[model samples]
Target chain A: MKPARAAWLFLAPALLVLGVFFLLPVLGALGLSFTDYDLYALADLHRLRFVALGNYWALLHRPAFWAALGHTFYFVAVGVPLSLAASLGAALLLASPLARCRAFFRTALFAPVVTTAVAMAVVWRYLFNTQYGWANHVLGAIGIHPVDWLGDPHWAMPTIILFAVWKNFGYNMIILLAGLQAIPRELYEAARLDGASAWRQFRHISLPLLGPTLLMVTILTVSGYFQLFAEPYVMTEGGPLESTTSVLYLMYEDGFKWWNLGTAAAEAFLLFLVMFAATLALLRWPRRSGA
Target chain B: MMPRLARALVNGLLLGGALVALFPLAWMLAVSCMPPGTANTLPPPLWPAHPTLDNYRQLFAHAGMWRYLGNSFLISGAITLLSLTCNLLAGYAFAKLRFAGRERLFRSLLGLLVVPAQVAMLPLFLLFKYTGLVDSYAGVVLPGAATVLGIFLVRQYAQGLPDALLEAARIDGASELRIFTTIVLPLLRPVIATLAILTFLAAWNDFMWPLIELTGQDHYTLPLGLAAMAREHTAGTESLMAGSVLTVLPVLLLFLSMQKYYLEGLLLGGVKG
Candidate 1:
């Protein structure tokens, strides 16, 4: 049999699945977003009005949409940097020669990455409880007042951010650890021969070589941080005056709960647009700065 | 002496980080074993006053958690098996076969990664609804059954296979399917392990798609059930913690057992890709 023909046969099933289930629905979303496809449209095709861009237009005017967008951006802007720093810090520590019980520490750090987000979020909610949580308990011991973690709008997002950092930093830590390991020990030795300090060696030798890996990790982490749904959903239910309401959480409510399919599709597309632009900017920034 | 101080500082920070990472999970375990309302007390007890299985009993007996557990296992297992086959075949073909437009097709698929899955989700839900798959396991499993990342992972690993070996097998008048099953499959064991672990873990921990698709209580996965249970009974702290323990334990154990393959897949998918 022809290899090409056999290849086509092998590819057929997966391509069919991807096309029908994933790619086609993406196009379908674009179509849905142009109209007011809602619970009314679901019952009868006659009610489906083709109001081109109307959904997007209304979303632009909706203050709730703006607020959700604001909260999501806040999460990405703050969460991404904090997450990266923590991951890099942990990776550096683990990569140190003096570190002991390396395997146990590595697994322990990475454990939270595997646990179900909803389950961990539940645990986190209990831990941050104003009355009974360990967080306030530790604070009280330090002579600080117990703060309402999930109930106060100002504190809710920060608490969620902390949870996000703890849950996620390990994943990137593993990647960055691999990155650090890949850098040759000879370079550091050479730097030391030139009387370079540890910080200077990291600044000059390690940082430059780890640039590509760092950028890649940052891009992946940034895109993932944008899709902040399950945390807000399980932890606060987008409560505390909706301070933790991410764009994806809003999309879930608008599309799934209210059956505002058109508006939700529009919101989904806008999110895609923002994420795409962000990724492109990340890709271009290093090049533009002549790095 | 100076180096000793630095070493101590580094190890101390690592110990602190690991403690922070593992504390919540440990607390969840401790809280789940506490008697009802024990966890809600002041200065939250680190250890239960009297450890008991009451919360687990309530979870299984009253909350009907067993059903959701079964559902999660069934769906995740099916997805892992199904998607592994799909991704393996396609990935091997792209790497080794002489198909027209193979590179272009693979590149286009990679390009699709930039478009968030949520963009397709609303319409995908509608499509599933129209096809009567909304509440079924198929709706949850089918979309996930063949992923671009899975294919990419497999293809990257498969590209290293010696073409001479494949050629020799083909010269022996072996059928393509036979060559794949008998010759390629064994050699692809490492990647197969990686992809299977990745897929099963993702499926088990998946929340959003299942949350949307599985509308009925009977079809609910563990994450969905936990979320619903969390919302409905916020006061049932002990049982909720028990439910969370059940939901997290399987995948946590799987990950611990297969850390090497899982971490390898992450680097492959994230850094290399």
Candidate 2:
């Protein structure tokens, strides 16, 4: 057999697997988004109607869709920066000369990266329990009233946010540490010699050098935060009133729970559009700023 | 003089950060050891007055955690094996094979990484439900078989393979698959190990897809089982910690043992991919 033919055979298996499993499903989702195909439609394709963008239109008008979008945006808007700040702080600390037990600290901080999110959420859920939780017990010691962490709608998302930051800040911290290491030491030395304060040195030297890494981390974290399913699924089950119903959670509910496959497909596409556009915007903004 | 004060303050901050980072995990261990309801007091006890393994016994006895652990092991193991084979072959082939449309195909596959796996997931569930794979191990294992990241990693390593060796093998009348198994697989050992750890870690940590697909509690993996136990015992603190411990231990061990390879994979996936 010719080597070219053999090579084709070798590649064929993987391509076929991806084609049938990945590509077809992705395309199917796109088609499903346009039709009013659902569980009822699943029972018989004859029930399916070609509705064009009617699913998207209905999703826009649906209050649930807006609430899901708000929850997701709230998650991304608040969660991303808070996570980045915690990551940046941890990374900066790890990068600092004065920080002792650097190895121990880095490992401890990054420990959550390997943890199952379902398990992490479970641990956090117990930790936030109003009666049995240590969070309230500690507050009680400080003479503060026991705040219902997961029971209150206003506090539920914040608790989830805090849980997410604790679980994930370490992943970005490691990446940022690498980014910090790549920044030339001579730049910091020059700043220090010029009598720049530590904060000033950070602003001028560190932040500018970290621009690309910052952008990359933000894009990754934003897109990651967009698929906020497991946290809410485990901790809130989409809420104390759907306060934590992320786009992915809503998609899961509409698709799996309600069997509204068509509407769920539309929701998934809308989420994809938002994430794709957001990522592109972030990627382009830096180049534009540089220009 | 100023630097000394700054150093002291920084030391204090470092100490505070370490406690914050490590406290929850430490507290988890402590609380698991405490008797039920003992840790739920006005001032939370730092150490359990009477440490016990009763929670673990309870987990194994009634909570059915052992079955979930078995599921986690079996599913993750199957995924790791298949992912290594498929990803290594495809990754290596993409890196060095003389195939038509190789670059374009690989590029498109890589581009799919952007469309969050969650996006296709809604329809993917319906797709699986039709196939009778839902509520079965195949549902969890099939989609994980071939991954873009796995292919990318192997390709990066495989691009470094010597062309002359493959040519010599071909001259000896060896088929492509034979050469790959004997010559290429040996050379790709480092990447295979790295990819194995990564694939296993991901499979073990997977939550959403399995949660949706594994409708039967009988098939719950560690994460799913943990979630179920948490819901079942919403007020049971000590038992929940034990459940968390069971869920996290395998991953923690794998990570600690193979930190170098995993860290290398992380930086490689980040900077290069």
Task: Report per-prediction Cα RMSD to one decimal.
Answer: 0.9, 2.1
Question: Where does model 1 exceed 4 Å of error?
Answer: none
- Summing lDDT over every window of 10 consecutive residues in candidate 1 chain A, give the lowest-scoring window: A201-210
lDDT of 2 by residue, A178-247 (tens): 9998998899899889999889989988998898788889999999999888998889888899888988
Which portions of model 2 miss their true places by more than 4 Å? A1-3, A141-143, B164-174, B233-235
Q: Model 2 over residues B41-157: C-alpha lDDT tens digits?
A: 755677989999998898898877889999999999999998787788788788777877888988898888888887667677778878778899988888888888888899988
Model 1 gets an lDDT of 0.93
The CAPRI-style docking tier of model 2 reads medium
Per-candidate TM vs. native? Answer: 0.99, 0.94
**Candidate 1 local Cα displacement, residue A155, angstroms:** 0.6
DockQ of 2: 0.61
Best by TM-score: 1
- Residue pairs with colliding backbones in model 2 are none
